[model samples]
Target: MWPNPTIPLRIKLSGTPREIGLEHGRQLACQIRKQIEIYNTMFKETSKLDWPTVRDIANEYRVTIERLTPDIYAEIAGIANGAELDILDIVALNCRSEIALGLFSDGCSSLGWKFKDRTLLAQNWDWTASIKDNLVIMSISQQDKPAIHMVTEAGIIGKIGFNSSSVGTCLNAIRARPTDPKKLPVHVALRVCLNSTSAALAIAQLEALGSLASAQHILIADSEGPVGLELSPMGDVYLKPNDHGMICHTNHFIQNRFVDEPPWLSGSPIRLDRMRRLASALVADGETVTREALRKKIFSDTFNAPQSICCQEDPLRPLPTRSSTLFCIVMRFAPSTRPTAQIVWGKPGSGEGDVIIMP
Candidate 1:
């Protein structure tokens, strides 16, 4: 059973794309259905569009997804078959970011610091708590790509995670776009990044896919270092680390080119500053930022109340719109060794949390 309140369900997947997706669908059918329900409510409330309309929008991306990444589409088909849900429903979940258009209040804070021995990447995934139970940790093994270990919603193929090649990524949903449905969807882009052998290769793959579907930030890091890739349908910007080898991002775009929605989350700028300050302080004395340092100094801070780094639900908003830090993950990447992660199933430093370590 999942949503245990202490630990997230962990599942291992292997073999062909369809087989892995089938096992994922079969083992977590209940969670998958629940995710649909949650997203249905969220879509209606946030996008002002009912499930049927959302499905239609999701279907528009079908041809593009299948044409660009047939293997992923096959896996999606397997998931739909195994879950006994329409393929469109599963597709909608994967395309939620594009459909929502960054209208949702959900926001996340992500940072990466490269060290002499290893690089540290971390993030606090802030969103409505309604779907907490649907969260799962997946260890996926495929024939050609590096094995992936990620924490994603039940039906999404990609999200925040690292790979056997020591490559990892963090996502910040930006509220700006003239989305090109013909391009790669956000979550699918995440899967492509996770499948890469290095940060440089990941960027190359994302570039080859053409313009991203919507506005988003993907913090990609490997043993070589971290780069903040701010992607918009209009264009792309690469945010390199500071002189100290550190970078951080929140909901809003750091660069000025792309237009963004009125600071929808409001905390976007505040959290970004706090994150940089906290992360800079840790490494100011030339101290290597460790997972513990990130967990303590960066992700746990609640500086501006409901809008702080460790975000809290704003009761002023409607129940469907309220948001909070659902989970926190910190990962370490080093040369010639498998990357590792430490996940706090609940809000980090909230005292009521279970920390899980990945293999």
Candidate 2:
């Protein structure tokens, strides 16, 4: 079932990045606090580090984030002020993967399908189920940039969303040789992608971040077409749409040359293959893939139980250690005047979500 009707806190704020962050923090203070607790607990259980040391380490990530982009830094600072938390704690939450030191990675499915003049960009972000109620969708209007509608976990600056510029990004985790402590974290890099107006620009930004942006598959799409990157702080790989005119990326690297590192997420290989077949069947060649049709495939659970595409918490694992499909999102940019993104909270096919319009 959907986590709860009260979930997916939606806020629309237009102003400077800092101002937007402050309003975001003030409105979602409860969730921000709860999410912080959850993240700290996960860090403790997974890594031997305590929350205090995590904060100190978060300072380095702060530098990375700041050096990467000043606007994002101000936004984080504003969130810290509005939420009444340390800037480093918020930074730590954003850099959770780096904090884990490459021990954990999440699963997701991102696909792009075209029909006529429309493009469908969709993803299912699978993570810890505990944050189902802590999820949020923030509509941000910043100076000199396109308005953004972001569907993400509390305190995450970016994830799956489309900008008013018709640019959309979907993220998937891939194992790298271990994160370089000096580079930008995945969450921070995602913010850079959302700020971009085109896939080529995002690729340039990712390249600029260098090896720090590594160990992930990032799919950047616009009304024209889409581009995929298997980024590593060491180097980056470029992925193009296959002959089927579709791109389906799971947690593992699909590019033969880039699949050297093993995946941190279990069942990644199976999920990738399953999603490809499903995408082929759901979106035929040269047919306009409607939002409804894509949504149905996104929420499919042919495997069901613990291993299904729409994952559920495994009874065999302890409560805090399990991960599930937290949310599913479909971002349609060309069907309407502005970008419209719909989400599926908690389990798939529940059909409960809010329509986010960025005008």
What is every candidate's alpha-carbon RMSD to the true fold? 1.2, 2.8
Alpha-carbon lDDT, every model: 0.88, 0.74
lDDT of 1 by residue, 36-150 (tens): 8888888888778999999999998877899999999999888888888888988999999998887777788999888788898999998888788888899999999899999
Regions more than 4 Å wrong, model 2: 1-3, 211-214, 256-260, 283-288, 335-337, 351-359
Worst 10 residues of 2 by lDDT: 350-359
lDDT of predicted model 2: 0.74
Clashing pairs in 2: 211-233, 211-234, 212-233, 214-231, 214-232, 214-233
What's the lDDT for residue 157 in model 1? 93
Which candidate's lDDT is highest? 1
Candidate 2 residue 199 C-alpha distance from true site, Å: 1.8
Q: TM-scores for all candidates?
A: 0.97, 0.91
